[model samples]
Target: MAPACQGVAVAEALSIGVNYGQIANNLPSPARVSWLLRSMRISKVKLYDADPNVLRAFLGTGVEFVVGIGNEAVPSMTSPAAAQAWLQQHVVPHLLSGARISCVTVGNEVFKGNDTALQAAVLPAMVSVHRALSALGLQGRVNVTTAHSLDIMGPSFPPSSGAFHPAALGHLRPFLAFLSATRSPFLINCYPYFAYKEDPARVPLEYVLFQPNAGVADPRTGLRYDNMLYAQVDAVYAAIQALGYTDVEVKVSETGWPSRGDPDEPGATPEYAGTYIRNLLQRIEMKQGTPLRPATPVDVYVFALFNENLKPGPASERNYGLFYPDGTPVYNVGLHGYLPPMLVSNAARQ
Candidate 1:
């Protein structure tokens, strides 16, 4: 068993979040990870799965978490009994022990492909999960929703005219309604790095990296956007509003740049990745809001915590992490986190 997280000073409060993924085998134990995160003062974390060791490690430290329901598990969750049973086992024990889990994503990027069965099951699974949460008396405590890939948007440029792809509109309309009714934010994974990597000749590195650039104007609202991240966020707001739901708030579920990549993958370097994250963190720290939604600050979760060596894809896919597996920063962004020596952590557990 892993040791209880100890010997770390309490973290100072910071609103920035990071995605904690564990697709690799060499990552440190969750107890040690909890220490690393607290030292950096990152107060929110989103995980691709509800790893009990992780939730258990953070108990009572006051870090907020957004847990996931993997794609394969979504279909089974359509059964109210199954959803209830899953939650009873995975969530209840942790919350009872004071883990601050705030959201449950039923599936990820569900409409990104043409799998009719998966598409059909996503919403029902979410519905069943919501019902189960209410049955467990946790509906008001935790939000229920899913993350979406930005491909669901059509012509995702020029924020004002943004609309959903005809193929995704049918699914998105009802999905947006559920969010509106439940008072949950619409989560979209926005990656400007993707744009620049695909066409570095056309996509300006300055604009995509949140560096100084000639801002673009949305003709309809006359809103000016200096950075691609804000533009992509407003584009999602436009898409949601077009469906006749203005109350649903839009939040970025994932966004990051890679520190390394294959030869063909352009703009994937530590310099670009560090600059992007540092700038974004600065904006988030200042509570900066998008031009369209000037009053409400954009809520974002940076893509990942550590670069998982085993992640399958281009090298960039495995490189979207702020830190390496040893809990060292991939590139320094002034966040001085600490990881105990392996022997120290193991001895503490023993």
Candidate 2:
């Protein structure tokens, strides 16, 4: 077993989850990361893929996981044999060892891409995965769903006027039906940072960063929204309600501010990033919910645990991490983690 970070213990527990993305080569081993997460008192984690090393590392740690089946693998999940095989290999082993696997996301942001074939396969894949889970008697225990990009929504302003893009409606109708029938949550990646970056001249940084501002009032419902995150979430709720489904829940699958960016990427500073996370954490700690669903607390997973050096795209893409690879925090958001020393091969043998 890998050693735990020395002198590290649980601090103030936050109900928020963090995304454990591993699109980098320099990241600490999963065993070491397990200790880091525990030290920070983060009980929930979201992975873009069902990585066995991570699952095995967190076994018996009492951390709940939301694992994903990648986009390329979605089509194959339509086959019962394929889906069952996947669960047996990647998920079942860890579950038997006491790892809490609460949800399985069949695909990530399928509609955002231009691939029509992938868009059509997403729902079928989810159905097959859900069926396989039922066959294995793990249906109610593990909810099957998919995460969507905010681009799936048509007009997200006014909150009450929110609707899914007509191009995506055909796929989303059945998608919402599946979520409603199975009592699963609709997961969306909400990035208020993007809005500010896209239109810094017009968009108010205070609104997006959860800072104190006059706030915007939705003209239709007259609901006051102080933060863009809540507005985005409420818009999603409205979109789902428009589809004639109110039984489904909506959760933020990924949301974070980049601490750095290119020349063109605005509002990607450490200060803004820290403020966004800190303020969001404060609200989440208060058990706050969106304007549309006042009774339901907003469920969110901050996007990325560590800076990924190998990630492709803009500079900001690689800078969303809350921590550096060595476990040092990128900014002080009241979160501290310790990456245990790497285990040598000889140590493993011992």
Candidate 3:
């Protein structure tokens, strides 16, 4: 067991959210995480699941949450009874405990592949959940939505012309209507690092890193974008607008740079990660929205508070954490936090 988090404070409330991923053999208790989050004044958090212990730990803490239902459960969620049962079991208990459940994500990145059944079930599951929320009088208070990987877009370059792949539109059109009608936000996980890494020759390092660079112009909109993040966001806006739904909102549910990566993974250093987060935090603090929607402030959630060793993929997949499991900073973001001292095991006494 790790000691309860203590001795961390910042100047203002953190509108920024930090992901709480626990795919590791070792992790601090939810009680300790509560202290850590409160110490930093983080008012929002996104979880891959609705862990009862975690929900219990954050009771009455005023920390809004966006919880998810795994991909395997998407098909089951299409059944209204299953959806209501899952909500009653996993969600209602939390609400009963006074947990501030802000959003329920039906499935994550389900459109990234050819799983037509799962893909088709995405919107239905979201509908079931939204209807369930409405039945329970939680429609406006607890929004139902899903997150998508940037891969869903056909041509992300020159962002203003962005469009969903033809294959995804069958699912996206109805999905957009559901979101617009329910007044929920569309969540997208945008990673500019993936773009720069795949085409270093064409994608300038400075542009993706949020460093000073001569950015490209959108020939269509003539909107000057100096950073790739904003460009990616605006592209999504354009795609949504093209769908004939101009009233829906888009939010970045996941975005972060890794502090470490394999030799082949270019530009994944602590310095660059620090720069990306610092610059992003500055922009967010300014309440800066996309170039297309300057009046609406961009809502973002930074990925992974602690790196997970068990995450399978490229080295970068496990290295996006802002902090290590032992509660050490991966890189300074002008804020310092403390994790309680780790408890020792008897086996290590040898």
Highest lDDT scorer? 2
Runs off by more than 4 Å, candidate 3: 1-11, 342-350
Error of 1 at 337 (Å): 0.6
Q: Rate the local accuracy (lDDT) of all candidates.
A: 0.89, 0.90, 0.84
TM-score of 3: 0.93
Model 2 Cα lDDT, one tens digit per residue, 1-350: 24443233324456899999999999988877888888788989999999998988877677899999999999999999999999998888889898999999998999898999898889999999999999989989999999999999999998889999999999999999999999999999999999999999999999999999999999989999999999999998999999899899999999999999999999899999999999999999999988888889999999989999999999999999999998899999998776667765225423
Candidate 1 regions with alpha-carbon error over 4 angstroms: 1-11, 346-350
The alpha-carbon deviation from the true structure for residue 349 of candidate 2, after best TM-score superposition, in angstroms, is 11
lDDT of 1 by residue, 303-322 (tens): 98999889999999999989
Error of 3 at 237 (Å): 0.7
User: What lDDT score goes with residue 6 in model 3?
Assistant: 24
Instruction: List TM-scores for all candidates, in order.
Output: 0.96, 0.95, 0.93
Per the 3 Å backbone cut-off, how many clashing residue pairs does candidate 1 have? 0
lDDT score, candidate 1, position 293: 92
